[model samples]
Target: MKAAVIGLGVEGKKALNSLLKYGWEVYATDLNVNINLDNLPISLSSVDISPQNDKISFVKDNLSIDLGFNNQEKIDSCDAVVLSPSIWGSKIAEHYKNSGKLLCDVKTKHRDIFTIGVTGTNGKTTTVSMIKEILENAGKNVLVGGNAGGGFEGYYDLILEADKQDYDFLLVEVCDMTVGFCNHCFDFDLIALTNMGNDHMDVHGSMEGYKNSLKEFFADKIIFINNNQEYKEEFRELSRLAIEYSKTDYDLDLFGKFNKLNAGLSEAITNFISENTFEIDEKIIKNTLKNFKPVEGRLEVLKLNDCEIYIGKSDNSDAIKAILEEVDFAAVFIGTPRHNENHRLDILNEVVNANPEAIILFPGLEDTLDQAKFRLHALDYQGRIEIANNLDEIIGFVAEFSHNPSILIGGNGQENIIKIQDRLKEICDSFNHKENRLLFED
Candidate 1:
């Protein structure tokens, strides 16, 4: 069989590797010029469906890269095209579809793989990680990933590694941005929409676009939804098997009611998994999750002497809102403004509304002074808010302000989060409190 793997992002690369192992003649294409093809025949352009040698290879030909969509003629000639979820559901994709030829998805297909997709405005990564730990404790082969940044390919990488042995179940944390890119997925065996909130409406355009995306996922697969009146339509659609994810809850290793909702969904889905040949151990799930260590950099708690630190997902509006709304934090650290207007506007609004005694740290990207000023002006904060983006300068600021401050390290969209994580941890360590509590939905 010949495979035409589209896009070289994490998912596409995994799908391509899978195909290669299956002994299929694979022709990989990508718009990104930075794809490392050290051991693979990844060509630069989406020239055609046929596999070419070094002559057409971007690395060999040394052609100037063009970061654009794939070429159509090649798309038409493919035996089977493996699509990344990033492909937008527009007429372009519609035209690319050939019913007779296979249109497969790297992250989707084979619901038998068994998945628990955690969805919502926030708390997706943390809850998903809890489920993953619970499963790992239960000795189930599970991989988790989706919209919370690194969760993008993180679990898929885990899955590939587990492939050397044999893995059974997969847990995925999905975001509207990634999930919204594709209207439907054939891979989800079960789903958990944590709780809906205001986010990404700029791209989704309106409430309708956002709601419809959920509609499509439930329409395509067996789903479990948050017990809120807001998604009455979604509930109506899945009335056949609707289960309330968040209602009366217990104290959880995770943060708030939002996290409880995320965990509840995972519980229901795991129960479903139990119904099969394997009987899932409830005790294991509860125990594993009791001390479930959250991922680094997400709502990570950094302790700087006599205080528990609260770092955040840098950009996840829901996670930020949750901590702000629920936790009685000592203080909150807010990141500075960015080029992305929507992010700068929305995040600042969320931060200011949280109104925690706030100290702002700036990443200081080029060309955002005016936008930053405009955003700061728009939000009226009830808490102390200051701006300092310089690394060394912020280090000094943290030293003085580190006492009992709930450090909220927001994930990057405005600034590179990986870099932010490093800096925040370094400062936390300096205070001799290396306790970082990460909160996310993977």
Candidate 2:
């Protein structure tokens, strides 16, 4: 038997292992033409297998590698083509589907362990982390990881590891990009959504398409979603088990109203899990909630001298609006990679409406500064606009010139936040630096 795996991302690597385990001659390919594995001809060993699987090695004899393009004819020759979650909606996946080839995603064999799936446009990582903390504090063994994707192992890796360990619960963070495939790949015992928003419209194609995907993915699954979610009414009729949750009064260490909603959802799930299975103390849940700090990339607060700066990932208008609701910022900086393809220019209107005193544009995937200036000009925004050379420039301006400025930094992930923090530290370390009390003291 022969099989091909397309898109050598996390899920694709998992597919390779499974196909090789089944004794199939596998042809692997990735779209990144610059993979540079000895100019494309490479062995299966070239891929990074998780240390957990170091003991279980694959037979290299049946593996053939190709990078850059997915040769339709070559893949069609295989009995099946397994796609990575990242490649789900691509032309290659569509081609395989219609080419009479058995097209599928990396599938997890049914396991008896109780599984919980967390998903939404945002708040997935925070909610997943909260759930893990609560579960662990309650003395339950848990294996947690999924589309959390911010320097965490992919869900495919976690699921495989879960099979080897005797875990009480398997927590998976499902992103919209992977939600459709997750429906077929994971047998989730329960699913929880923080909230829905206008996100990933480009990947899903349209708002209706995005909503439909969520509806279908949540159908036949026990789900907990925000009561105010747009699809709440429809989900009640579609989901096999649907429960609506609202904001809670739990004293969370995290910031923002959205975090409160996430806490509420996590609390509801933990309470239900306790009632049905292993009992968790109310005190433990409260303590866990109280001690659970905000995830690094979501509404993370920092200090530059007396100025308060808040940073988080804001890709869509809904997220930006949500942040603006909780943060009273005098200045806001926004950036996004491939801004045009990722979203429309209208998203900038939200920031304008928020009426920040000043707006700064930082370089991102493209000329976001110029693009944003054009949009702001079109919108006739009244705020002062400036271009920042880097995060260092923004930090210096806020620290030296501003009067305890409240700043909001948007449109970067956790990795970028770390880089920004490093740059801030370097600035503080310099002799020509503004002052002490730079960041992270409190």
Candidate 3:
């Protein structure tokens, strides 16, 4: 058997190793002209695929390498082509599919473990976490991962982890980037969609394109859709049994109405598993929903002095609006660390329209301050706007600038929001309430 692995990113490398493990002759290629393959352990004789030994060694001895370009001859000679998620829907991917080659996103390959894929523009991470906890509490062996990237292992990591251990189920947090083009290929027994928001337009190009991908993903599957979602009717036409996740007012430790919906989806899916596959105690599902805490950076609350600092994930304008609506904050701290947001200006506009008493623009890898200033000025916003020189400046301003009890912080990306959380924690630890008191305070 022969296989050609395309792209040498995290997922691509994992695919290469896994193929070689199954004794397939491998041909590796990357479009990156200067890709570093020194760490991509070619000699897997001593490779350790454990949780701790994530960074394996690499070389070019065992497989044929065609870096800087995708060699057609090499691809034609292979029986299968494993693609990185980043290259899904590309010309090469289309060619492989049209040619009747066994194309894979590395994630969709046949596996014995039962797979439950959870996907949505929002609340996916929280929902996946909820499902994992519910299953674990029921004493079921499960492996949870895929695109849940707040320091969580991804699908690639899960594949490596699956090689060493036996799991009854794999709870995968699917995203547009990971499974949009090749979802049908994944061997999922069930799928839970949290809700669709106006997000990922930058990647999916438009709402129609995004919805089409999702429709194809859920087609012919035993899927669960949030009842609150507008497209439930459309999905119901395609799914084998489209279960609706009802909204509940369960007394939850997590903040916001969205979380209630997330918990609802978790309950629906876990209950299904219990009824059909496993015997999960109803008490476990109830307790998990009632006590489940918010995932990090999703409506997370931090305290510094008298003010409540809320850290949230605001990847789009809808998310920004949701945060503003849920938390009655007097001031907002917004950043566009990635600047690649589909609606960067719209996100800033959303923050401005919230009419907070003040808005702070913190510097990031992108020039978020400039965009915020332009958008605010254009909107004729009269609220206080402060431009922070650095993360430390944000803390200093928050400490001494406002007497308001609530301060909301968020950004355009999760990784960026996590950074803000870390900085806030550090500053709060060393923060002196007395010396840096607000102007209105003593």
Q: Give the alpha carbon lDDT tens digit for every residue of 200-286 in model 2.
A: 777778767888888888888889988888868788788898888888797777778888898899999998888888789998888
**lDDT (0-100) at residue 177 of candidate 2?**
78
The reply for model 2, stretches above 4 Å from the true place, is 1-4, 9-27, 31-64, 68-82, 89-110, 148-150, 339-346, 365-367, 422-442
Give the TM-score of each candidate: 0.75, 0.79, 0.80
For residues 117-195, write the lDDT of model 1, one tens digit per residue.
Answer: 7776766776687778767777877755555254454333333344444557767677676674432443666667777
Write down the lDDT of every candidate, Cα atoms only. 0.58, 0.72, 0.73
Which pairs, if any, clash in model 2?
A: none
Q: Among these predicted structures, which one has the highest lDDT?
A: 3
How do the residues 56-136 of candidate 3 rate in per-residue lDDT, one tens digit apiece? Answer: 222344577665566678787887777677777788777766766644443343366799998877788888889899888
Query: Looking at candidate 3, what is the lDDT of residue 269?
Result: 90
